[model samples]
Target chain A: MREPAPRSYRAPSTALVPAVELRGLVKTYDEGELSVPVLRGIDLCIEPGEFVSLRGPSGSGKSTLLNILGCLDRPTAGRYVLGGTDVSALTREEQAWVRLHHIGFVFQSFHLLPDATAAENVVLPLFYAGVRRAERERRARELLERVGLAHRFDHVPSRLSGGERQRVAIARALACRPRLLLADEPTGALDSRTGASILELLLDLHRRERLTIVLVTHDPGVAEAASRRIFMRDGRIEDDARA
Target chain B: MAARVLRRHPGRTLLTVLGLAIGVGAFIAMVSFAEGARRSVVRQFETLGTNLLRVRPGSRARAEGVRPAMPLSDADVRLLRREATTLALVVPVARRTLAVTTEAGRVHRTRVDGTEPDYARIAGLRFAAGGMFDATDLGTSNRVCVLGVTVARALFGERDPLGERVRIGPALPARVVGVVAAQGRTTTGSDLDDFVLVPRTTFALFLGATEGYSSLEVRPRSAALFEAARHELTTLLRRSHGLGPAEPDDFTLWSPEDTIRAAEETSRILGALLAAIAAISLLVGGIGIMNIQLVSVSERTHEIGIRAAIGGSPAQILRQFLAEALLLALVGATAGVLLGVGSSWIVAHAMQWPPSVSWRVVALSAGFGTVVGVLFGYVPARRAARLDPIVALRRE
Candidate 1:
């Protein structure tokens, strides 16, 4: 009944443009006329299928950047082109459309609905994409299996451990097969071994499917897993390195 | 999806639904019961005459303390019938509650009315079988009586009661000359068909010269002469009772139609009061719905974030919660209708009021619930739809 239900993406095969393109991005929070800038003049681009890790301490504006990249928040001034469409100037509804069709997000908290089973969590994005119920279930099963969570399909988030919850989150993120995958500390809440396994899962997904992944984390061990890493300090990128 | 969300807190949801149900049920029951009472009053009044008047002996204390009130007698019936030119019919009714025995050895206590043959036409008595006591029975003081439909059923259910003999007032045997058609309950909740009728002359044999009739039913020939006929009868009765010019009349004359009309007005006022109370209860129910919905919205703020982050639009979020509230209220409305109808029947029987269930009243009650649902669901749904996704997701 709304927006003609977004269509599926084509994996950006033989595409010339980057999956995410941002130029001179600025995000300012206004509290009683006091302008607190979070992301100031950030310029970045990520090619399709690239695995990138963003890292910084608190107050480094990495979270704001991730939120802007995921289309959950808008930059105060910037031109953001996702899937070759200028989306920063788009309306809030159009932004939601882009988020549904082009971006998949995994959070540190896993952000799985407590009331839904693991398979239902995985089916969420495809449901918003207007995929039919039978196909949604089939794809949920396929993605859950791909994430090595085939056994926990019927289990809710509370029934599964932290690593298992993160895997379900990953399966959910890939439900629509979005061109851009954003993870903000995907393993930040798990134990060291579990966190390492979650990171290994993300890297394995990247290598197996050539899926574009942009993850934010602090552990050098996590940064070690990515091919490229960007570090931010005080609202600006301080370092960029290739692994 | 809304059902799934609501099912998460089953206790709260059920309580909310029950609140709405009570409101709707109470409203429908009040209206339906009032309508039943109104219909009963109307039925009672319909059989009474516009030109009809009732006359009974006045109270003990007199306007002039000198004269003690004398009892009315059969002489008054004869005098009113002979002397009054404007009056159409003068029928005296003698009533007594006594136990009567049937031939089958069954005994039931019922009211007995002693009156002349003209009382039949005045009271609209139609016989199911046989006929009323004739003028010969009245002149001879014959031991013949007519059984009301209720008394006949109680005395001899499904059996022909025309020739049966029933004992009146302990061993005073009277033949059942007729059985009247069924008449419904009165406005005062007594059955209209629970009386036995017999000739006035024969009634004197049981009580050994009982003085007068219990009450008199007077009818004027036409509506135009009703007041004049009442005045002439009052004058004749006063003169016969030896009340002088300075003394007040010894009996009271009033129109039964007027009394029933006043009672009908009172019922209308009571109906309005009930509607007010019902409105207040419905308002309370709506507020309860809003309160619960707002709590649900606040409690599910994180879920809203998850939904929004997963690409559910503001409209979709709004639709989800609004639909749930409406669906819950409709279910309550349905349950309330059953509760109302069930309780109304029980109350109608317990209070002996007529049972009149109107489906229009049911629709109005359920429609009111729908209005209540939509009115309360909008606020919290809008609040949920407008939540900031980033901040909402950040909340624990």
Candidate 2:
């Protein structure tokens, strides 16, 4: 006799809270007797699955703001709430843990380890997150497949193309399945055609995974792909526009 | 990741390891040379009778500048042979550092040791060929000689010097009766195996016109009799020389105990000096590691930044760099030890000196190398650890 369709065991998904909440964020760098303020009172909130772009010219502190938002850098004074934890006052290790668990960053240069293969690069964040080896490999392969670089899993950065490298970088950012994705000019290093393709791939993933993305870029064309854009100048917000 | 990183830089890593190996090899060789010299000296000293005691005229201070030989009259030898109870054998020996010529045109400046057949037992001479001079030869003052291996080789050259006669003084001829085995060279100043042994009476008749006897060797029955023999000999010499009770004795007696003490003091000083010289290589090796570490940090700036950015704390960065530095040093040290040992072997073979390979020296040298690495490499590793990830990633 034909058995009834097996019951699917599924976990519950609860819309808990906003992904990130920043209040009066300030970051000042000490340059050997000179104190340069990079961010002055940045107040912003990103909801779950929102694609927000930070746009500005060079020396506008957009990168600094993105760094703080990504938890890669800490503000001199601020209250940052990320994934239910107040992370601004956290120790470097705690901040790293938050970054490891709740956030992921993608740099403009596709900063994949040169000595590692594409799959290995993707699995790096999971390594720090204390994931089991077999599970990390499984996730790494799945992410590579999602980024359409499954065939190039074993290829090193040196052997990969610019677009391929960025895809690997994106795949790495998603290894921990972070709540907030921070892409700092992820397409800047690629040609226009390849950049567009990469952006499309990012948009597709954003839609499929419903992942919150905060993309930083100087290019309006790149910024246009996001649902919203925040313009910055001289370490202050100048304008904010929604698509 | 480390394995992959190393694999990627195979050439660089190999070159680094090779450089370390060279350093280690050199360290081993030099240490071996010094050790070999030490062993050679000890072996030579061992050939001199361990139970033998030497008596010479002078105080310790005076002995340092110029050594005056102990003079023994014919009456003194007769008295010691008849009256000395604690001594096994006491023979008056006069050694003059003089150049002797052979009819074959070979001239060598060597010691002419004058003693009787008892000299063999007193001086610990093991004859390789023929026989030592008996009491009859000494009584009649026969011009018979026993040549050392080196002297024999130089004078006779592959042919036996036994049954041959060679010139001692200008016209004085002595017959070579026996050839003593080459005991080897001494690290000590004295050339014990580079001399000829002749009858004591003959030496006194030929070379002892100005002095009665230059030195006297006394062999005690055992270690127990050494003190008694020394005391009795001292009193006898003082009395025979007619010294007053207030006057200092003219002769200084040197036993195995004294030789050992002197050797210990000298070895301590020599060991420190040699160790210092060897330690300098460790310093050089450490500096090499430091310089390489600094270069490595700079070379892998982007890599360090990436590691830091990817959840690696400062301590981890520090550990990674330090590990690389330590690994380099440890490899170099191992190489140095092997090199040191191998080089010592080569030196021993080339010089034909008894090589002594001290495990302590190897361990000490290796330890020093390791310390040098950590001390010097820490600065660079710290610099790498403290590298601002932002600046580092941005660094070209």
Candidate 3:
């Protein structure tokens, strides 16, 4: 490998730089003496500003793949490059730093802190990133307003409806201005009408900010809305389609 | 954030705080006991003029502290006055607590002191009105007395106590010939102006209970000659008493500072016992905090998952819980210190001693609580930080 050029605010501008590129990515969990392989050899590349949906059956390992992509879990045998950084080789604390700056996660059931105000939940990532108090709060307010939760800043999760809580979670995911956004069934617990509103809000952010997104869901209708879609079967990608 | 977490479980937080406060408070209050006692001893002894010493008939192996002092006679006083060149004054005093009844039948419990005129001058007593009994009065065994201002007021009301008669104990009637001026309050709570004094010659005929006088109150001419005075008195007493080279002298000498030291030595044992109890209490409180924190980590596993998922590192999680523990312990320790200091003040007031708060103990106890918070809080915080993000999130 040749020595790389010193990077700047603008990422290396090769003609077509991929936002996320994984090669032969594999993950295995050791349960006692049994080594359970979750992901087999998998190859995928996502370009910047693309909205990609992942859909599969329950045991198809879509969630595991998303976890690996989000840097919440490590890949056992693979190279994962996100925005020109080889994140797979980083240490655990370094991975947390990578996730803080490059990866955003919105979970199913809208995992906003139950006792914290909406603004507080939004400021969580910035806190880990060591942002100053005034700056973190300012960013929290701006992000909540962007997610259409401007009036719900002080409300805890219990006071917010399913759609509003999901919006807060989405606002939190964008707190650090992450390069890649990952949603694991962000709308699964909401009714279809509320779910559609959340999907619309995410789409608006994606288009306006040109954020690269990877969303996993079992709903075919949800999968069809993405610019690109992938199908996973038994820990391997079976199909990749572009809209 | 740590405060918010504690507020979510008000009952648990209060329980941990109460445990620590009780421990810290007990420790502070107990240490203040020794401090207050020492302060009162200093105050009490300062009331006695400096360069003064007491010589009694027995050695104070008498750190045999509670034993009664052996008696000294008028002959000892005469021997010191005649032979000891370093001595300024030698006065023999015998004392007893007796109820004095005024002519109008009023009663007061007071110390009846039997001594000559030199006793009044050495004790720094001044006359508010009448003068002390002269040496002529002592040599003649006059039935005359001098009353301290407190007893004079209690027994005489506003009437002139001069030439008045008061009964000592049950029968011996002595006429009040003079009144001493008001000496202010003593911290030992004993009223310095609450006694009556009569000539030692008269005291023997009236009380008639003892074989000889209580002890000799001796003073050197100046502070510079104090050691010389002590040596002179010891040599003269031994020679007069006919002690041989090997025989230990029968008399003991007391300086005011020695009395203060003896009092401190007695309180030292009590101080140690209190410290042990306080240490045990704080340890128990620390263990309680650790056990509760362990339970807290397990119960909040899902929350820990959420924190990690949102970009919290293991170190960050550890710091958060550790801060929570410290916050709890710190609050408890502060409350306990205030409680302990307050209780100490009240006890000192009740005992009529000035309240003394030991600030050193306050800092030590609070610092110990903080250390305990870190020591005990570490295990649970580490366990919380090490949770697997996926499994933690998977829990309900």
CAPRI-style grade of the A/B interface in model 3: acceptable
lDDT of 1 at A215: 94
Ordered list by DockQ, greatest first: 1, 3, 2
Tens digits of per-residue lDDT for model 1, B1-396: 778877888999888888888888888888877877887777677677677887887643455475655667878878898899999998888888888898779998998888899888888788999989999999998999999999999999999999999998874799999999887777676788898988887787773555566788998989899889889989989887888898877788878667778767877888788867987787787788889999988988998899889777777788888998897788778888888888888877876677877888888888898789768988999998899889788776
Backbone clashes under 3 angstroms, per model = 0, 6, 0
Deviation in Å, model 2, residue B217 alpha carbon: 1.5
How much lDDT does candidate 1 score? 0.84
**Number of the top-ranking candidate, with TM-score as the measure:** 3
Between the candidate structures 1 and 3, which one is better when assessed by TM-score? Answer: 3
CA lDDT, candidate 1, residue A92: 62
Ranking by TM-score: 3, 1, 2
**lDDT (10s digit) by residue, model 2, range B1-396:** 444444456777666655655556655566566556656655655667567778776555543434343466767777777888888887887778777778887887788888778878777778889979888888899988888888888888899787887988664588998988766655544545798888877887886553666667888888777788888888887777776787666677787666555666666577667666656655666777777778889988998877667666666678777877777777777877777788778778877787677787677667777777778879999998788777788865
Tell me each candidate's RMSD, in Å, in order.
Answer: 4.4, 6.2, 4.4
> Candidate 3, after superposition: displacement of residue B114 in Å?
2.3
What is the Å distance of residue B24 in model 2 from its true position? 6.1
Error of 1 at A234 (Å): 0.4
